[model samples]
Target chain A: MMQKSTIRVLLAGAAIATVLAGCGARDKAPAAQPQVAPSVAHSSGNAGSSAEPQAPQSKPQAPQPKTASVHTYFGDENGTGLVVKQTTITYASDSDKYGAALKALQHPGDSKAVSLFDGFTFKSVKLESGKLYLDLKLDDQARTGSEAEELTLQALQKTLFQFPEVAEIYVTVDGAKVDSLMGHMDLPYPIKRSQ
Target chain B: MKRLWVGAGLLLGMLALPQVAMAAGGATTQLFLNGKPLAAEVPPRIISGNTLVPVRIIAENLGAKVGWDDRTKQVTVTSGATKLVLTIDKPEVAVGDKTEQLEVAPTIVEGNTMLPVRFVAEKLGLKVTWDELTRSVFLYKKSSGTAAADSGANGGTSGAGGSAAAGAGAAGSTGANAGAGTAGGTAAGGASAGVAHAAEPDPDSKPGIVQAIDFTGDRLTIKTNGVTTKPNLFHLSGPERLVLDVPYAVLDEALKAKLNGTVGEIAVQHPLAQKIRFSNYSSDPPTARIIIDLKGRAELVPVEAKQLQPGQFAYDLKLAKYLVVIDAGHGGKDSGAISVTGKMEKTFNLAMATKVSELLRKEPLIEVQMTRSDDTFVELDDRVAFANTRNADLFLSIHGNKYTASSTGTETYYYRDESLDFAKTIHKHLVPATGFADRGVRQEPFRVVKGTTMPGILVEVGYLSNKNDEKKMFDEAFQNQVAASLVAGIKDYLNIQ
Candidate 1:
């Protein structure tokens, strides 16, 4: 019985080594990051930031999830400019911080600022190779004039650019690229931090 | 057992093929007018490669009165001075005093008088388009003047210009029936020619009809069948004459014949005018020109021109002043935005605009005209067009702002460089009197401000979402103060002491 148990342990060790070897080349590339599926079940306490390497925990614990303090921009009272507000968002085990920060934008808090996402909801928030892709579901009444569109887009860009991991932002509606967000201004395919 | 079942299914499928083919061959045709589905008591259908629709349905929708004579088996359609008579089973149609041939004539089907769709629609001065893919026929009023058969098209009223052109063109062809009455009549007939010709170019748009121009005493009344836009009046020094150009309007047959002689002079003797002459000014846009030879050194006063009714406008030569158009933003189906107190923004805008208009009306030499006096929706394009066409010196669009609940301020926007001073002058008086935060005068390409030729500005009185601002904007005393300040600002800008 002892000999049979030793053979099973060896077989398990070899399977892990083979799986690690298959992604060995990709692990060394500087530009390539772990492609996290949005449906992956993450652990609490320490999933680590996207900028750092994730360490596997030997013993999992039911500890408190980490929270991040993010800076979000909202429309000013007159809706002609953007105003910044600091927000602290709590994340679940499987939730992404990028998504949590975006969700906080819908609520303007006590700042008396107008929300740009009033008639919109987030469909997906994804980060790949320092590029953040955001898909939004628009309501039928989601219409803005030219002035409102300019100020709202500025608010969104200012909010997302605060994250160090996000180098560029790409916005789509219901998973498809459209000509304009509110039929007023053209949306660049990948909105960079400069804009 | 499985093989037996498969054989039975195959036999059943073979029997259904003929029924599907028959359905495709006899497709039920649909009819649409101005992009709305028009349900007919008898659905339109294709017969002998021509589409036929109920006569009363198409005629009455085009704003024509239809009468059926059982004795003569005839259908008569009358619009304004124009009349069309169609006999049952006769391929010839009588329009006014002229006769035109049709491929298919009026016929009685199921006790309803049916006529060729395109022929009757064109005779009634409506644009007709046929779509074979959906087996639909679309008819539009000429005033809408859009090529696309969609409801989003601009809804301009069908002015008397088109029917006047049709009537005049029909009468003009009576003496010379051998030749087609210009391209207007041929274009209407050509658009009606066959089936599956959806790709054909649209017929020429008929211009607004100018029925009569009567000048008596100091009042000159221009009568049209439909609402004619404001006329453009200018004075010429060389001939010492005053020229009045009516846009999108054409002279009727009787009037055209009356002014057929050399120089087309109408004998008139009045203190304001010595002689009156009329002519068809521009054919492409169908503008009618009426020139008045002024006596002495009297200048033609560019004032007292008002739209008396839907299709009538009168000019009083005794008055001269500046016209200011006040526009209230958003109403009716479009409530604009709901306020923090659940009040509609359109209501506040109308109240403020009306107050300002009332104050401006009391001012000497300052004429006030409002885009809307009550709760009704007007298109953005139409508002701009109204100001430009009326030759107004200034245009002001009043609106209530909406943002976050904390938003409270007053701001004004101007698009053109020339309107910056107007914006600044208005805001200077508005902000101090309202006692709200002065958001400053800014530049934005709002539709009303950008499209108007005259100096125009759009002012946001206060944020409707803010509780304090909403309460103040709805107050009668506050409205009176704001209205007085606005009039003072206008007087300052126009240099009216």
Candidate 2:
């Protein structure tokens, strides 16, 4: 599991990897310490420490995402509608994050979390013609309205765009291009990652 | 003074002809281009105030190959520069980079595909004219818009200023929050308020028509028909051309005569202020785009002044300056997040944004502008527009986080991959100063970052939902400290002293 509790420490080390390189690089900085700051996360953690960042205990291995974490921007009923929450979703293989992310979207674990794909059924997600075709089945085609449908599409589009391998998103209801979700909001316009 | 007055009179004479030529009374319209008659098989007719013609008739002659998918009910028209996609009975048409709503959908006529003539022509770069008296519709591509259209090919509303379109919006704060304009934004839901989706159809919708265009003293003001419109204005370098897009506006053939759409080449000489070009970027909620190519001694000034009218805007060109626009997250009816202390997160955001701007201004040659200098509500789209039109080098949006009083930390977000380094560079310095848990720099599709063409970041400084975090954040002195820290971080990221 790629826990923020762990990766943060290593990320902090990478941020200060210059510190461990023995001050030989920059001639005029503070004398370099060859240690990694595993406790760097805590420096900001309610510690209220005003001191400069210290060096971390040395580690030989390179910093990389050995354990993957899924960052989900779930709609928060309390605050700004959406608050990002992380899940320790590491795959057995490196290529498994896509499946895991979809699973995470199905259930991201929040009491106030609103379902973006509620009326729509998840039929399948396929890569066709350089675009990701997300085929869905509608539960109630007649009554979808402005508020819920737009939010759902926003959630779905944002979530799918996270995976760069999936170039664009084309949503279909019961294997057909939809005009709108409930009545007003339109759908399946080949959603691309916003530049 | 003499040149400015001369250009203004010429602009009046140039633009006045189109409005006079398009006086409405047409049942059936004939096609004409550059004084030449255009013959069509099906003939063009008006439906519900919009003109519709055979897709093949207009599509084929405009140097386009038309294709149809009968099973899918889709019509795809491919041209050299633009691809037009429309579905039968569907009110939406996909133009390049935007999905525009058609006032009337396409239908099959006899054996041919029929679509909105104004929409198809405007989207395909063909200018349209409807003479009510003659009942004639003219369609043709100008041989002169090369310099203007060529400028359109190079992307971005900033870096080099370009076109902009403004659609009048309803007074729905949270209602239009549902107006999802977040192009590739990762921020999930509309937590803030007063974000009205301008393009949504309503009876209150105003027509976007260009009234008058005046080029005086290096500034160009493209006035609209009735009410004023917020125009997207830009100017390109290397020949210095001004481009303006009036959203929800339409054009008649008279305006086409003024343009020189010889794609990709700038005209250096013309009898009327270098060369002039115009294109209808969109028709559903129609947008009228005008580009003026400037010649020797022509330079655009950075200041943009909105006239006394509701939508009259005048701007000169300003290029290659390192200007930073700091946006305070939410305001007024857009309460943003309600803190645990019952304080609005918008309060904190504005405070932080103000401080950052104040501190950054202290730096030499660094320009700083706040999206909202006070507590006035600025919509999501407008916030990006302010940064873009201002030609900011970097943009920073400030907001406080909200959750179940437990999720606490400082997290910085970016939309594009290029902004990651900018986000990280700021987070590296900003997070440590907050004395909050570092959530790390992450990439999320956010409007402030995604909607902008420059390096932009949205900083969630701390969680107001958390009591401890709120305590530190609520401190006015603490906000000033965070603001100063943010400024230092920006300086670090920008590599300025």
The A-chain TM-scores of all the candidates are 0.65, 0.55
| True contacts recovered per prediction | 0.08, 0.02
> Tens-digit lDDT track for model 2 on B183-219?
2111111111111112212213565566566666555
- Runs of candidate 2 exceeding 4 Å displacement: A1-195, B1-320
**TM-scores computed on chain B for all candidates:** 0.43, 0.42
Query: Over the stretch B1-497, how does candidate 1's per-residue lDDT look in tens digits?
Result: 00100111111222222211222334666564543334454557688877898765655465678897765878888886779898998988899999998888788554357888888777766657666545667665543233233334323323434544544443333312211111111011111111111111122436677888888777677778773455655444444555565655778887888755413577787875787877665443345667677674343433343536567767655534678999988766446556777787778889989999999988877888998899997766567766764657899998887666777889888989999999999999999989999988988767678777778998888877789998998999999999898898899998889
Chain A of candidate 1: what's the TM-score? 0.65
Tell me the TM-score of model 2.
Answer: 0.36
TM-score of each: 0.42, 0.36
Badly placed stretches (over 4 Å) of model 1 are A1-72, A76-80, A84-104, A107-114, A118-150, A153-195, B1-241, B244-316, B361-369, B376-379, B389-391, B404-406
C-alpha lDDT values of all predictions: 0.64, 0.56
Give residue B78's lDDT in candidate 1 (0 to 100). Answer: 88
